[model samples]
Target: MLGSAGRLIRAVVDFALPALCALCGRRLAEDEVAVCMECLTRLAPACAPFCRLCARPGPRPCGWRGGLCSICADHGRQFERHRAYGLFEGDLARAIRLLKYSHRRSLAQPLGVLQARVVRADYILRQAEIVVPVPLHRTRRRDRGYNQSELLAQAVADLTGRSCTPRILRRRRATRTQTKLTQDERLANVRGAFWVGDPGEVSGRSVLLVDDVFTTGATLDACAAALLEAGARSVAAVTVAVAPAPPTGRGRT
Candidate 1:
């Protein structure tokens, strides 16, 4: 029973010194993470009456006739559809920043759960046969020590009971960061950057592409295009958050 004793000792230590909240640095109760319940509740809620194509807030309900946002209709995207847990702002944005740039992997669990919840509630993820995170290039993965999208996809797969094929998609090129780039530049940067590991694996399967943020949709579009090229029956996207596009006058369009 030495192993059991060791487990008990570890449990006791954990109980005595609970992990602190990652955001506020306050002592967390058992099972709490960097985000406390209070702060989590404060996050902006994303619900119905959203565009069917882009998941942006819409004035009309998501009726059967295929709800499409004006922007989405004007400029069709490669992915079939997109959804996110919340608008990127406040603590949500901060958490994403920490997870992506600061290497705080712990945030992935909560964010993934949140994304899965949104997907389930919206009925978007139920049809997905497999989940694939937007793969990072080998160089970037090595530098970061982990792929944040993979972590998020794993959590989503766990919650949804779907298989997470982390290696199904591969990044062939190490591209520059998408941040601070124009939409055209982002598109150019990601072109020819991705490939499929096994085309047959996803053949005739519905794939769910996962990522941390939906910016100009360039990254997700690239990933979705690759998956479709690999013979995926259909491809959709789910992200932790969606940044509001700036006004057309400000170069968003």
Candidate 2:
């Protein structure tokens, strides 16, 4: 069809002229990927000594005995484990904001590929049989025209040779944004907000939940809880970034 041919031509053009860096708008060099080498080096890599349960930076190396953090120890999380590519700060955070809020869906592919690399290196993600992105409410999806998480999930699935099920989970109710809320408030807002479209799709399977950012862990917990309730054997989380815990209080790990 002519439409299909047009699409193919567009794809070729895009491949020929990849967009510039979302942060700096600089043309990437031949040796560079989505981001230039300078920006990539500036984005701090997450080091170890993180919580085995949630991947948040911790005070000391986790022991295999429990491998849990204070938050996980005090309040058990529904998700089995979590991992992220970097801390939510500097250029990484700015890039994510552009992708999520600025309607730059093209950025998802490169970021998702980066996340896939991180997940592959982590043992928890390697064990997952399926990947499911956190769903957006219908209203939000309509406004945004695309789900950033789903885009990331698709890229990750392609890179890892895994299945990306964007619709296995659905947002059952629209809730207020979590950005302005306290930790407990955020949990309350998302509680009972998600539902499984087909429980059998994930029955007895290990799932990797994908999201753009990990702030309070409330959103991931809510999604993981729904998946477990729908018969997923276990759920691990992978995010592009994890925001540093606030200074006054501890963070969920």
Candidate 3:
């Protein structure tokens, strides 16, 4: 009886004030959730010509060696591999912004399910024994009231059938946003910022780190390094989107 009443109320409310796509602002169909199909189709997939180690889309830099991008070839990465669902542009970027800044927490479900599809198709990513979300600093999390990555991680774990272990990783300090920082500065800022709360939770396990975006990969690298130091067998990363490489003479995006 309660279920029927709830459905009726939702139906009336939806009819009166239909839900709209979080990205495009288009009215959602009865079957659709947070985003419209047209907006979703506009989200470009992170396919080919990308760095194998870090999954940075586009051509490798000049003098690239060892089949890795110049950055990876030079500094190397702590994670064994990384994958992203789409390029960070257009609808995809908007969708992430809605979830992260606008507090449209509902968007995390669809975005994470989409990311899981990418993970499902990759044999390497599918082998993740456990899923972990990058941790937010305690103060920041308290201010936000929720961790966006943790919400995404839960959805991904549900779809991928992996255990979501969010409490195992800890952010020791809050760092400034990487938005305008240089690549080197971004690395330095996040370095030693993460730690494992319980090494036994990640020890001997293949952890798949989840995040909203992959920029210069400094944050992911830092998290992966901490996981590895805690005796994790391997660490791989997945994100909803990957920001494009910065233009010449520009700081990291």
Candidate 4:
């Protein structure tokens, strides 16, 4: 009786005050969730002609050499491979901002479904034994009352049926925002900021790291470094979006 009444009430409320698309603010269809179909179609996937290791799009002719971008070739990456669903721009970027800043936690589900598809479709990524999110510092997590990366990791793990070990990694310190920082500064800020809780949990296991975005990759690299140091067999990453590469910046592992 209560279930039926709840459903009826929800239906009436939805009819009277229809939910709008998170990105474009269009009225959502009965079957639609947070975002409408048109905005979903506009969310572009990160297409190829990108670096195989880091998934960064580059110039057509000479952007790669031996399947690696110049930065990957020279510096090497801690994570064996990384993938992004889309470039951080347009509606995709807007959606991410809404989730991260405006506390639109529900958006994590669809974003993570996109990430799970990436993992399922890639042979190498599908081999991961465990999933770990880039951890937020204790203070930050307290302030936000949630960790966006953990939400994403849980969703991916649920869809992929992989073990989500969010507690395996820890951020030992809080760093300032990376938004306006240079690549070097970003790297320095996150270096030594992450650690593994139990080496045994990751020993000889492949780890898939989840995060919201990839900028210079400093944070991901820091997390990967801690995982590798703790005896994880390998590390790879997936993010919802990848920021455009800086003009003079190089990749980090």
Candidate 5:
């Protein structure tokens, strides 16, 4: 129903603004966001059959007798509980990699919105007074230009009406990447990497720790320890992706 001029303008706009899915590299439909429906279907959720404490996918989907993984069973985590959207694989993993390594800043909001929806549905995030991301060192943040976890935590705060208090939790020193590190090495790598800048910021408040992935729980556990030491009432965590059980062979988050 358009005239020649209108049709020409429409065509040019479409050409100039091509829509592509961030995960699968497919052209997006008219109303699609960063990810396409096909890619979404390909992505798997961290449903039951996962560890009750850490949310790691397990062989016994419905048979978590004690609802604990070996890590959670042998030694308790510093956080009260952990929740993850899905495993770090396929489109989800690709998307996270793009956000973290490839400098895909636009993908953060879309991913954050998805994660915020997950948090809004959970009562744990609702009860938390503030959201604090697993902080990065000054050098790392400078090199990265931005912290992806900070973006995610802010989006969650926007959706759930919780305040993002990142200043309270900070990295005291830089450490080697968790990549290529053994379980014990991962724990020691992040052992004293984090600290609370001001105890009053989170004193007497329950906090939610945000991270991109849950590998060994070392990083989030370290952050939780600092929060608790500073007088936080309680601490829980939510990550976009949760890794598989022990003997993991993935890169750093």
Candidate 6:
């Protein structure tokens, strides 16, 4: 068949080129996006009732009643609620790291597609008037040459029929990396680090913030607070993955 011949040729071309599945290194089909079909499905682990505020994954048989996690229960969060697609481990972890650190910019499309699925499932997010990725500082963006979160935001915006508004939120200054900071330290670090660049764009409108991971709630919360301060009606957030609930009594981040 002509179609079969075309697919074979394309697959051959993909093999000869840089266009392969970032996760498995398989030559991608013409219809396939960033990740292959198998890996795309693998990304959508069940997101049961998580913390209404911080978006932490609940334990097995998680008895959450749309309530707060222990960590979130005691603290106030800037965003009303948040959700994630899967736990940040295993294949999901590998894919994100490759996309982020290895300069696999092509992976953004598939990652955005995965994030889009989560948006469709959440009614509140589905109604978001605009989509914004957590912004990278100017210095960081210059170094990386692209913001992965913005790449994901653009894809989801295309799918959701909403505008991607990167200019609305700005990182006023770069802060320390949050890799090993405790919850309190994270809150302190990102505080006063973000603000709305333009008030007219977000006023009285619901905004959906996107990010790659939800380790500490600090970054997303900080971003949401800026939107709210700019007169945005409400702010909600989504992420590709969330860290597993720590084995003991506290957050891992």
Maximum-TM-score candidate: 3
Question: What 10-residue stretch in candidate 6 is worst by lDDT?
Answer: 244-253
Q: Which stretches of candidate 3 lie over 4 Å from their true place?
A: 1-17, 60-63, 248-253
Clashing residue pairs in candidate 3 are none
Candidate 1 per-residue lDDT, tens place, 54-166, comes to: 77664455542457765566667878889899877788888888888765677888888798887787665678999999999887787666789999999999988999999
What shift in Å separates residue 210 of candidate 5 from its native position after superposition? 0.7
TM-score, per-candidate, Cα-based: 0.84, 0.85, 0.89, 0.87, 0.85, 0.87
lDDT per residue for candidate 2 within 57-141, as digits (tens), equals 6555545337766667777798988889998888888888888876666778778867998888988789999999999999888
Task: Please write out the lDDT profile of model 4 over residues 15-102, one tens digit for every residue.
Answer: 6976888888898898877788888877889877778888877776264678777667777889989998998888888888887876
TM-score, ranked from best to worst: 3, 4, 6, 5, 2, 1
Q: Which residue segments of model 1 deviate by more than 4 Å?
A: 1-18, 47-50, 57-71, 248-253
Candidate 6 lDDT at 152 equals 81
TM-score of candidate 6 versus the correct structure, residues matched by position = 0.87
Candidate 5 lDDT tens digits, 1-253? 3455654675576569777887777898976666787876677766777777777777865455587876787888999888888888877888999878766656666677667777777787667889998888987887776788988888778877889987779988899998778777878888877889989999999999988988878888889998999999999999889888555544454
Score candidate 3 by TM-score against the native: 0.89
- Candidate 6 off by > 4 Å: 1-18, 60-66, 245-253
Instruction: Give the lowest summed-lDDT range of ten residues in model 5.
Output: 244-253
**lDDT of prediction 5:** 0.80
lDDT tens string, model 3, 1-253? 1244554675576569868988778888987778888877777787777888888865654435756776788999999998999888877888888788766777898899888998998877888999999999987787666789999999999988989998899989999988888888889999999999999999999999999998789999999999999999999989999876786523433
